[model samples]
Target: MKELMDFNFWEMILRTTLAFAALLILARILGKKQLSQLTFFHYITGITFGSIAAEMAGQTDVPFMDALIALVWWAMLTLMLSYISLKSSKFRVIIDDEPSIVIRNGVILDKSLKKARLHMDDVMMMLREQSIFSIQDVHYAVLETNGELSVMKKAAQQEPTKTDVNAPITEPIYMPSEIISDGKLVVKNMRELKLTEEWVMKKLKKKQINSIDEVFYAQIQTDGSLFVDKKSKE
Candidate 1:
């Protein structure tokens, strides 16, 4: 009985490994878009592949050949969709939705938002993440193919260009930081910086920062200096 059980365990492992390898190869053939910049159809293909892989992994009776066939079917379907989307604009529109102008000339287009099934709150959050406080600052805001917002600010609202300032060019700010960010660490940072928690607390005490939660971003520059940017806990 023990030998039989071990045989079953080994079979399961072998099948799982094969399924994983097959998925990886098929995914690579299907293209890198499977992992990034996914469209609506790409998302559906991912879900289908995941379901098929799970079934192949858990069901011992399912043949490895069957799994391979299913994977081939999905890959063919993905190729067909890609070909159609590339060859015809109408098919591309059907497969991957076109970019919608959510904001044009600093005016929020309610019709575009409704068509895109996005809300004002969602728009506001995206704007905030882009460091845009007011809609007036935006010249055009496009909802991209990957479901991300691409923002273009008005000329006046953008960072001061040389033409705007009518000044001579100077050296641009060069980033020289090895550690750009350290998020929420009480012990790890102490070890990394070669300082105790008590010393860190003392440094924070000078700036009236009582806790780590007050800091949203912390960076260590090449000069062995630390810069802290804190956000309100609220």
Candidate 2:
């Protein structure tokens, strides 16, 4: 127990705290898409940062300053590359690969599939995930850099939009905001919508809702309509 007791707890705590802070800062600098829409290069960078940070957090023999410097330098290099990529289209394509057209005009491009290192089974599975069963249904399928297959269905297989028909559009801009959830009023939404409790009560009264408790859920539509769902007594 002598060696265990002799271990510098305070030093370890400082290292962990510094490493965590550095990680948070680095994550912010890297941007939200680092995890969300990750490319191959970014995926590797994320792993590298995690491994280095993990080592610094627990490895007492590893100097904190050295680790911190390494992390900062890496982040700076990443940012510099990102800036360069933003300026040069060629560099951007080199850093993050361009999307490949795997399928064109309802025909699978065998060469593209081979270059992307994807099999026919992989393509079919991706299509199935997107609710596409028949390859004939797909007009075009682009293999994204992040490994997602973006399929465009043929005209006959696609769903018709509102513009396709001569239907009257009610609201050009439609955004639904929740005003009440689980019998509780969302004050922030109410304030943003510039709605008073009296206004809500009046709307509720119109629907024969006497109390907020009656509402299990409620939302304000873009047309200034209140959609109130009453709690089921059952």
Candidate 3:
């Protein structure tokens, strides 16, 4: 009980809060790409950041400020590397890695697969996820740097969409706009679409939703229809 009520306990709490806040600010500065599109560098950086933060929070022997400085330095280095990669295509290819053509013109490139450190089973699994069960249907398949497979089916095997079928092209296709996500209003999206909060509220009211908090997600389709998913009571 005495150990729980010590000065070190309170000091640790303060250190943890400071560490977490610092990491959050650094992540925001580093950009959203760290979360959405994590490359090899991003993955390693994330792990390193977490380890450093943990040490800062829990290790009393090591100075908290020193750990924080190290974290900031690492994050800055990552940002610098990202900027350099963006400016130089050669650097980008070397650091981020180039996509490998694992399958070309319906033939599996075994050498490319080996170079990518991927196996036949892995390629087949990735293809199945893309709805291509048979390798014969694949015209081209590239193994992306992020380990995602980009597959193109044979011309004859491709499904015909409305455009391919020569259907009347009505209004220009617009991507759905996310107005609300996880009960939070996407103000940036709203601004981009030139929509007002009152407009979104009116749409919600029409659907018998009293509050924005009741919605889990709300998207406005290209055709001007509001699609809403309410929060489920689990």
Candidate 4:
């Protein structure tokens, strides 16, 4: 009882609070990433941050300020690398790595699988998750930087739509391109769609939207129709 009473309880409390606060602030500063979207680098960084915070909270011999400084240093280094990666494609490739084409034109690339450190069973499991039963159905299978598998089915295996069967002359169908998301303009997508800011503003005006900030999302359909969703009050 005496030993328990003599323990620096107040100091421990203060250290814990400071460490937790630092963790929250750093997490916010680092920005949001979904668990499914976490890359290898992100996973390692998360573990390191948690370990540092735990040490600061539990270890009394180490100064709190020193631990805090270490935590901040790691975060700053990560941010600097992220900035450099954004500016230089080569740096980004070196850090985050490029996507690998594991399967092309219904043929699996053994070299790519070996380079990605993935086995046949792993690829098969990913294919099953994508609703593909056989490798013959796959036209292209790209292993993304985030470790997600993107599979494209072969044309022969794809189901024909109503237009394909009924129309005398069929036209290529285009996927809807997003031009705005979370009240921010997607300039690259707008350029790809061959749309101007003036045109977007005119469309918004027709929808009684005064500013781009009022929109939650906006997309351009294949038929040249503009779909707009206003930000909800909730």
Candidate 5:
């Protein structure tokens, strides 16, 4: 009872608060990666990080400065490895496993399943989750690094496209390219879309916008029309 009474509440509060702030800052620096996007290496690293932060926040006996140093060092190492992975494809492959062809030509590859550490049951379950009941229905199934099953159905099992229907071929559709964003002309996008400043201005003028700055957002639509949204009056 005496020892419990002697505990410094303020000090513990301060330590917990510091740990939370550090964790928040580190999370921001690491960038946002969804659960599906996280590879095996990242998942393990995340667990280790959470362990460190939890220890720092809950353990009053641990030195605050030492805990912070350990936390920051771990974050720095993660960042350094991420940089190396970005620069070197080999390093990236080392960190993240290559996608394995678990199923090819409607045949399940036992060797691939073993290498991916997946069982036949697991594969069947995954396939069923994707609405694929039979193994013969899949032409190709890739076990992605994140453990996702990317399936390519056999030609007979796949949906028909416009080309299959013998529909009249029209002009090829393109992605909507933003020529202007937030009242600023995007030169690189303009060049990519092979658009000139004069063309952009003429489109804006059609929308009753006299100047480029008057438009907040402008994009080239798939139909080759200029879509412009005027800036609201301040």
Candidate 6:
């Protein structure tokens, strides 16, 4: 029993306990953003802590002072990074994902939506919730980091902008672009435009689009039209 509770064993236990306490303290100080704001740096920090804590806790024969020193080092590094993000815009960008404009001129920016991992349906739903029944009403839309959509309506749609205008109105045309379907091109859509693969090839060639693999999304409208967005754009 005495041999089991030797200096090394006691030291290791003490170190483990102290390290755990320090980690708990730091977690509390960092607050809930550690979970809510899951940025690149936060992910890295979490993985580092988990790995080191596990290894250090298992080292039953290591000196308590050694574990304590390591814990302090990690804690200080994490706190420093957090402080840098709070104070520096450059650092904040590195850690957190930035808001991107996903809709421009009433048309969804396919590349931006792809980069943000959002679908057109999701964006449209957000728009509907914002009291926008048609995409034409939106001048700009941003996908915020919190997964919320911020929208700016067209001047003619908003209250103040419409108050001064008394122009005649036209029928609302749904300008939905049938760009892609099931991760493949809609051949029917091509036929509707009286277009062929030849025309698509021509447009692709103009944009230096050498292969269909380059395109992740494409849209077509009631008008003879097509829009291809490259996977590499993101």
lDDT value for candidate 2? 0.82
* Candidate 3 ranges with C-alpha deviation above 4 Å: 1-4, 166-234
Candidate 4 error regions (>4 Å): 1-7, 34-37, 156-234
Query: What's model 1's lDDT at 196?
Result: 60
lDDT of 3 by residue, 1-234 (tens): 788579888988999999999989998998998755557877878888889999998898889889999999999998999999876656887888877889877889989988988999999999999888999987778887889999867656777786668554343233366798778787866896788889899999999998999999999886677899999989
Task: Name the candidate that leads on lDDT.
Answer: 3
Best model per TM-score: 3
Tens digits of per-residue lDDT, candidate 5, 122-157, equal 999999999999988887788878888988776566
Q: lDDT of each structure? A: 0.74, 0.82, 0.84, 0.82, 0.80, 0.69
Model 3 residue 100 CA deviation (Å) reads: 0.6
TM-score of 5: 0.65
Sort by lDDT, best first.
3, 2, 4, 5, 1, 6
lDDT value for candidate 5? Answer: 0.80
Give the lowest summed-lDDT range of ten residues in model 2: 167-176
* Candidate 2 lDDT tens digits, 79-133: 8888887666568889998788899778889999999999999999999999999
Per-model clash counts, in order, read 0, 0, 0, 0, 0, 3
Off by over 4 Å in 2: 1-6, 166-234
Writing each residue's lDDT as its tens digit, candidate 1 over 1-234 gives 999999999989988898898888888888888766478778888889878987787788888789778878988888898987766656787888877889876789999999999999999899999999889888778897778898877656668756759654332221222221223543433564565656555666777978766776655543445577787557
Per-residue lDDT, model 3, residue 14, is 93
RMSD values, in order shown: 18.3, 14.7, 13.2, 6.9, 9.9, 13.8
